[model samples]
Target: MTTIDTREAAVAGLALFPPSLRISALESKNFRDEVGLSVDAVIQLDEIGVAFRRSTLFKNIRALLSENVASAEIIDRNNQSWNIALDKEKHGIRITAAERTYLIPDFSCLHPNVDNRLAWFDAETKRHGVSDEDLRAWRRILADREIDDEEVDGLLKQFRLTPRYVSAAIEKSLRRKNIRIDALIPDEVTYFDRLVGKPAPEHDLKQFFEHTTKERPGLDLPAAFLLSSHSFGPQSIALEAVDPAKVLEFFDWAEHAGDRFTQVGVVECGLRHLHKMPQLAPHLRNIIQTIRSDDLTSETGRLELLCALIMLVDGELARTGICRERQPFWRRLAAIAHASVIERAIVAVNMLPDDFIAWCRQSRGLHFYLQTFVDMRREPRWSPDLLSASQLKAEFIGRIVAAAPENAGTMLGDGSLELFDRASSSSLVAQVSFPFSFLPGPLEGGQPSIATMPQEIEDNLNEMLRSETLTAKSFVTLVNSALLYPLDGEFARLAAEGLARAKYELPNIKSSDEAFHLLVGLAIVASVTRSAKLANEVKILMRAVRRKPDIEISQENAFRICLLAAPASAGLSDWGKYIGDCATELSFEDMSRDSITTLWNFIEVLRQLEPTLLQTTSRADAALQAAFACCPPEVKTAEAS
Candidate 1:
């Protein structure tokens, strides 16, 4: 395979990673020594295994591995299967799945949203109001002083601009205008842009700054740093706080400040404390309806107005603090949000696509929420929308939770799956509590024989097991046969404890399929160790196994007994017969061919080690025993308890 194909394969492999791996960091040595070494063999995409390379997906996967995302999906768009999402994690251009399960890309890394920064800049300007930060930043860059990373980060926070945005502004100012990039970018009021060279009737900007900074104790601004003597103030209005009693007075002066800056400043004050003044919501809504489209479209104005609108929308609006006020404005938002199709509803409106969806994230209103989006994507959602007024409540919550990793628990009623595709190791680990269930995959290495897997992941799994934090699903995923299995004894302990705990929890799990997985998990534990306690637990699962046998799981159970108890096998002989009974009862269609072959292999091996019990009289069965001639004399079966 070419470099491109190898990288693509590596990415697909990443899809199989556990939720923790998708949102956590991994040491290079651990990944290379452990996960890296084993990944190629189990890649869901055959091409990834054939053309796989370590270097291809490592760089981009590093970032995706560390941060949270709002949405991650394998989308077939424009004739390409691309992985896209609204990334909230750190910066990067592409995402590569280490599991190689699906071909996809991370959205933010696509075309760097730079150079084209102005596309959104114009819209952002109104929402933020015109600040002299750009002009101030340009002038500061000319200072020729050394600047470091902290200062650069400060520039982003202070400007509310992306790193990309700040970088571009700095490039334009310094490379084009001989300015220093280290100079501070302003977050201050932009009352000076229109006054670059004008004669105003208000007070002198310099004197006013000095007087305001000296007299107003609470308003102790730099006053001297970014202002020029030529700059002038609007009217004689002084800056004031957003007091509930002085609300009307504030707006009065804001409108008459002789410049748009004061007007925007008033809007900012209202936004900061809008939640406290619910009575004023109606008035604010009126104000929005009256603002010019251009002003409402600017970035600052748009964001501020949206903030105010968000505060007015009813019931646990996304991002903003909750607002239960179902006002007429919500209807307007709904109308703006309406569409017959989920994607079309969001795409139908321009200007506020994301904002509209974000606001109705928890709403039950039909137009505001749709069931289709949730059905389209498999992820975690926060709530049930108990009232059922909206169909997409689950999807709504999922989008937000996917964006915020801190809120993942809201969706994990059972540790079945996360929002994205995952690799076999992570997926298997996730199902660790269920035991013999993870059987039919291509994994051939069993404990003590396998070498690949990072120490960090092993340590992490061990820690989770020791702490009893590993979920039952994760437990079963960690304890598979052959190629995919954990060497950590803590995992075994956790699996034992989990099996014990499962007896009480089984009734709570309504799905028979899920319960069967738990039963299979017990059989696996019994096969791997000599603990009487675990053996007793296996009896509990065995008595509880109400469903017809899952052949693959049964095959795995037999294979494990042969692998662990053969050659001087003692306590496992009966369990081996038990496993054999389940395995032999399976019809071809009832199990995967691979599993049938595996069962045949294990039965032959066990017959060699314990010939008296397993030897067959049937000629066909004897013929099948030919393949076991080279079976290893020693197996890793545990000492009998």
Candidate 2:
């Protein structure tokens, strides 16, 4: 055979070394003579692995070497040479007259002791010819506990085994010790990248996870590892291969056996991978249900779970696109964002750390905040801590203002005013007496009394009415001044007409501030003038405000507006019933002084308007009695009257 032919055979034979094996081993003249090939020929194959050696083409080259024939001649007569090919699989080593080629030696054929097996691994790893097959053989030999785990780890690191073999080693280690799989593998990008692609590593990962789950059951390590691997490490394709049923089973186990934090982490992982496995979409409700059912122990955990649920819903909405609101899932999500859940969420938002709050902001957690504000305002027993609920409302509105400052006026006016009107009216009447102080005394015919506006205020109102450049802010200020002093019939008509002009010019006044003012202005004018047109305008503006998220308007001005507007806007029939329902539903023992006072104001207003309209159930009466006990002597005396 020609030198080229002999060199080709040598190159093919040497292309099987693992990274731990030194290439310099082929440099020895004695080794070269023994192998019957040039060092250059062996150097060419250093990067190739044993899989290349097992190919049929490589086997044909081997047959040529065995026959002492040139590679060209063997290729020319492919059929005859293929038929003459030896079974290269029988042994990892082959010896011929021209060369001795080591493929992947069987270390088990030698002594089975720890020292001997380790020695074999060390020697093979140092030579220029170790292959992945050799690493596998070493793994099998070490699986018998012949070597210590430290030795296995050391060998794994020293030999630089491929991820597949490393995974095998990891699986074996897991079988012996409850150690993290990540601890066994190198934290190198290349190692993880290779691990992601290989089916053998994938299989080993699956087995290790299954073993860990079966043995430890509720340990978060497996879930954590999966999250890390799927999110930041080499995105494990094996995660997609994980059975949907298995994932569901894990969810079940996690729900019952895991802590709040672990359960949140599991759900987060599921959400992160939901796009890849849409089968998980249906189970999201159950996941949220699990979270909702959890004890209100860890505020941080509760916030985190809520954030995860928001992300899930956001993703679902984005995935489903424009028609999402019409779907059942949309309705379900709406239900999930219910008042009780929002109440807990509000508490969490109030108490959680700023970093978590920042995350919520970044993740659009304000959606939940808005939902809560809208839903809770309509509930009778809105919040146990009315003070906190009030603060949360301010915070929510503040965030909305901060997020879209330019649109604040229009958004708030159109969306928040009416909602705020209800709460503010309740709060204003319940807690303060100034708004109701305008009423005639109980001995003086029990009627609301109106007072003339001061000349200074009337002139300012006239100036505002005449000014063409009047803004919503200016309109609000003028109306507020008028309401504070009490509007006489003539001034109230002029103020109502001015409000009409402001509404016409500032048609886009959707701000909460503006809406609050406009609503009160309209109600005041409607009551003072007793005009159907002005009352209808109040209703129209109210309907517009109600179209947005709910807010409560509770201040002196709102009370004046409600008291003035109720008669002309129709009657306190609806308002009275709502207040009665709230009184019945309220847990007076849990209410604050301000909240109890607000409920009392609601009852007082109802009693003044149409006593029969305020239907009192026994529960409501008891609630009112309890509320009276918490009040000052003056309040109890007033209630007696």
Candidate 3:
């Protein structure tokens, strides 16, 4: 009906059509016109893949062209109508519009091979002014099925022209479905044929693991190990009950598995799980024993066994709802830490790298061992006599001191110096008080002998004093002749010097409380060494007791020492003075309830020791009256007096 410029007509025609139809029509335009058809005939061609004879195709094509609403016509160079042709035998179509003639082959002929027919159609659609994206959509249509008209209409509603857009969208949807369905098509025969050949690839474990990982990422290391070890199904709970032998086989496989760190992690995980199995303990123990005995013959085996032992002793395990009887883990540990065995364990520990050493040190069991070793010196020996017990304790302590890792001698006499230094640098003080050891039986004079302990007593004492941690009570205990055996004059002098140095080292001791307490204890020892005035100096230092000083313990301690140091020469007269001092310092207002009780006890001991003091100054009489009043009623009046 009308003629338009070639380029203008093509652009105008695309604009007249919906976007989806424009693209499809542009691709099939040459094919349609080659068979002398209008645009509607090309639209129908885009939907179905069926081919017809050229004569019949042309006749149908002309009917659609004659109804052209755009009123466009084919033209030549002279602006006249052009001839079109169709060769249905070859499925070839030729079109003449304006001065140009376009040849269009059937879609089947366009692709060189049937296998790539879709790809060729996609390429041609793109070349004929269809956008790259629309061409892909068209391919999807041809490839898919089960696409419905509603979905096509929904796609068309997004545009202005509904009718022209729906067909191509439906075709694209079908193509997509076809492609997917094709991929889903099974090769059952091929799969069975593969299985029929031989056994499967170790249950295809490696591939299955890879597939699982690719499908679901972020598995924990140990869990991944378990997964790779067995054909665990998709159900995690069900898979959890996998055969132990299969799991162990996976572990065995991992033993010689590649040198990947993952392999090691997996094997270690399996071993740890094995350790936790209650039923497997005996078996595992046997294996460990075997390894311990013979594994050392090979370096690698030894290392592995060592590593396994470390894990065995330390691993935290999950339970399978089973209860087990406890073993004597502590006794075993004691045997391990024994002098003979300890050296080997220590040497083994040292041979390991520093990180391993740190790990061992951090181990709960190993840390506990270190603490026990430090404390072993103080453990009491079963003594028949208090004196013998003391002797044995000292001897044991001496051996421990000898074991000190060098530099232990410096602070042994009085740990106060090191204590002061440590306190200045650190926030907390570590003080250990070792109990006294006395001979089991009394001497002819009923006095306990302090000397028979093992040589290790002094050595261990020195070791404790030399510790970076201070022993405040121990230092005072050793100094207090009232509390402990009086050291010889020479020993007393050395101790006094050591205490003096500690005072100087620990500047934090601003009050005479500590210094005076220490001095009083020192004086008591001096009195034991035959010096009375030193005991009196202790009295002067304690004058603060009357004023309710914070150093009441020091005062009480000083008084106790005075009683201990009072010359067997002072006899009863000395007791008068001691009783007077005790009366002055042990007032209820001046001391705590416990301290007052302790004061009463001291008077009792003094009364027991020197009954004549009661007669000389009536000190014993006064003490007895006080004890009778406060003592718990147990028919002990005779015992009191």
RMSD of each: 27.3, 29.0, 35.9
Q: Lowest-scoring 10 consecutive residues by lDDT in candidate 2?
A: 377-386
Q: Give lDDT tens digits, candidate 1, residues 388-424.
A: 2121222222222222233222222233234212344
How do the residues 185-259 of candidate 2 rate in per-residue lDDT, one tens digit apiece?
A: 243433322222212222323343343333432322333332221112212223455666777666565554443
- Over 1-641, each residue of candidate 3 has an lDDT whose tens digit, in order, gives 78656666666666888989876865574644554435322112223222333334444334333333222233333345544454455544555545766555433322224445465454444333223233356456545532232233322222311111322332343344332211211212221111111123332323433444454323222234322111121222121355666555544443433212223233223334443433333332233222223322443343332332222222111011010111112211211112111122323233333343234224433223222211111111111122222332232222222222233223222332332233444201121114432211111111223454345555554554454544345455445333344344445444444444444243333455665556545544544454444445444534533344433354355554444434422333553565455454444333444555655555544343334434443543364456546755445355555
Per-model TM-score, in order, reads: 0.20, 0.21, 0.22
Which residue segments of model 3 deviate by more than 4 Å?
1-392, 395-520, 544-558, 568-572, 583-598, 616-641
Candidate 2 residue 582 C-alpha distance from true site, Å: 19
> What's the lDDT for all of these models?
0.33, 0.40, 0.35
Model number with the top TM-score: 3
Error of 3 at 226 (Å): 67
Among all windows of ten consecutive residues in candidate 1, which has the lowest summed lDDT? Answer: 373-382
